[model samples]
Target: MITFQLSKQEKVVKSINSPSNNISHCAFLACSHSPQCTTQNKTCCAYILKHSLVFIDTFFKHHNLSYVIIYGTLLGAVRNKTIIPWTKDIDIGIIDMTYLFTKKIRDELYQHGFHLFESFGLPRLCVHKNISNRTLLATYDRRHKPPASTLELKVYIDLYSMYRIYGAQTTSKTPVFLIKTGGSFHALISFQNRVTIDEQTFPTIDNIEEHLVYFYTKEYMHGIMTE
Candidate 1:
């Protein structure tokens, strides 16, 4: 892992594999579904994503964390003011280390029609009504259905560990990461190369819904995937 100079002994997310400093020109949007799921519909899956977004946003807002629309969520935000009409899931993001404080957020949301799912040492996770507690974060869908869209509103969020570099392309894909805060491995990805998220000014607010499940140690975090 690459090390940077810091005054405090803080953990900085690092990518084990480095992409070129040039604008990332590669994109790997895996349009695939889980093996457990077969039929994925906008209504069923969108309900899960929508409920998840509301819960995440409201819970996090109570804790005063800073998050923003990311990836497909951001794209959808710009295109339709909501999840892409046909899209089945939603994506939101926060700066590194916010997940360290998710327990409190989870506890509070649980009282408001949410269910908490045990994640071992991972951050506290929750689900909407009727969602089953699985190892893959709590997920909920409208009942009376087999499965329309395989979109499971998993306890996953896009993490943007962008770097300070010269001549990065906004239109091209930039190498980005999604570090699970359960103190485990990290996930990597090439972001859209069009503009740098680091350059964009996300709204600064009091971060209330933060958790450690997304802010684990740097070493373990770097081992996550770039998929």
Candidate 2:
């Protein structure tokens, strides 16, 4: 029972309940990933992205990753403490110069029982696991996308790396980058340039070189996360 709190300028109805340890099959994906965001009424995924952000925040915090919600997620946290009624996805930003180490992180997630989609560098592309599965991690890859079928991605999350353009300048620009993994999907996935449709600025952390994070979890792979 998670408690739903509202932010300063809120519009969504909130429910005050304790957060649950029970995992659901949903993996928070982009707002456009589902049909519910456009429907007259919001769908379950849309509803959860608003409420479940706290859970994702908890995961990053537990992993010791200093992160802050951006885009729609941040808007919800700052304005409504809930997902915007028209929002269809969740986005979290990380600060760092994305090198070739993305694969290392993917491998680490694999050990945790998750399936790594491509090794980063893909646009509008993602990889994630079933949170509801007894296994903490599992990755289902849709490498070569066929014609009429939109990849049926179970709920997942997107992680972007932020870069600092210039250190000495007080007004140095900030931008989020997408890795180019080769091929149309992951391969030429460069900077999404603008993080959103409404804004032209990219998201960059003032201090990127110093604030990097890594997670250590062997429990999920070893079988179960024992209390």
Candidate 3:
């Protein structure tokens, strides 16, 4: 197995091959009646995404970490009150990466019925809910099963590492700032701005329209397809 090193001594192991295999089962936790929960019932998918957002928001607030909703998640929050009806996964960017993999965080997550996993160097916050052991025991092949001691994966929220870069000027008086997501830098996002959805508030970037345009071009205002 491959391990992704975060710092001098901290590392995360790739426990699961692909998280997508279990994402479909998340809708069962929300509403079990539909076999094709994601496509047949869009509300079930949105419910899972909203639940993840609320939990992560509370977790970050308790730890006093700075974060913002980005990508498709941000677009939904700005245009609609909640996540996009069709979206199966949620994306969030946290400013602090140094403290993410500490033992304290792991302990706290375990206490709250959550687990952390890493894939391709990106962290994922997974919740343990209605997923059954029997379902998880069946891995890539239905004919074979892993050890009964194997842990299960439920619905998860994707976490991206973010950093702030200062000293950039824009057309507006406000000092144009940039947020570094992975290796690329994006323009104009402030943590000071906040948006509320379903009575739950989240930190967001300023100049929503302009930032959306920067990422999605001029046609972004009308709403476009997002994964």
Candidate 4:
């Protein structure tokens, strides 16, 4: 059974329970180029993205927190009805609720087989799966060679904090919400209403096309299609 022990700041420590080896059906060996292999791999990745979203949706709902799909993940959902074939990570934005419950969220992700690691620095969490200690060592070892083991090493999801900018100069045209990425960068986002993906609706930015233009250049649609 999975359990959580929270520190004063609510940082989660590893539990005594060992991580599970029962990989989900979405886990794939790696990507390949032969037409058949490419198709199968893309299908597998799309399934994983869908499953990951379901878990995220359930978690946020249980916590009574509001979240929205964003970035490249949203583009894929809106345009292709699935994850972009070349995309490696999922992105979501939560409105000012994650900080207070970091440990709880980390523990929950751990229970579901995700290993949380800091990206850019400590406390900014990026959760991943199918990445063992051995794989991590191989990544940094100079002598280690490719074609490396691809037991789903890159399945990860990024969580962004959404906050409203409050100040005297802020105006209506100023975005209602800011989605903070790692470090100091933030992307402006506005929530007009919701968007449906795989028949489940979730909040999204108003004028998604405009937001997409801001986040990606005018060539965004063309670029995403190439790979």
Q: Where does candidate 1 have its weakest 10-residue lDDT segment?
A: 20-29
Tens-digit lDDT track for model 1 on 168-215?
333334322333343332222332122122133222111111221233
Per-model RMSD to reference: 15.0, 18.6, 9.0, 10.5
* Per-residue lDDT of model 2, residues 24-101, tens digit only: 222333334333342222334444443344444454445555444444444433334344444444655554313212
TM-score of each candidate structure, all chains considered together: 0.38, 0.39, 0.65, 0.61
What TM-score does structure 3 among the candidates reach?
A: 0.65
RMSD of 4: 10.5
lDDT of 3 by residue, 169-191 (tens): 35554433344344344545546
Compute the lDDT for candidate 2.
0.33
Candidate lDDT scores, in order, read: 0.35, 0.33, 0.55, 0.50
Candidate 3, 35: how far from true, in Å? 15
- What count of clashes does model 1 give? 41
Q: Identify the candidate with maximal TM-score.
A: 3
Candidate 2: deviation at residue 36, Å? 9.9
Instruction: List candidate 2 segments past 4 Å from native.
Output: 1-43, 50-52, 97-130, 133-156, 171-227
User: Candidate 4, TM-score vs. the true structure?
Assistant: 0.61
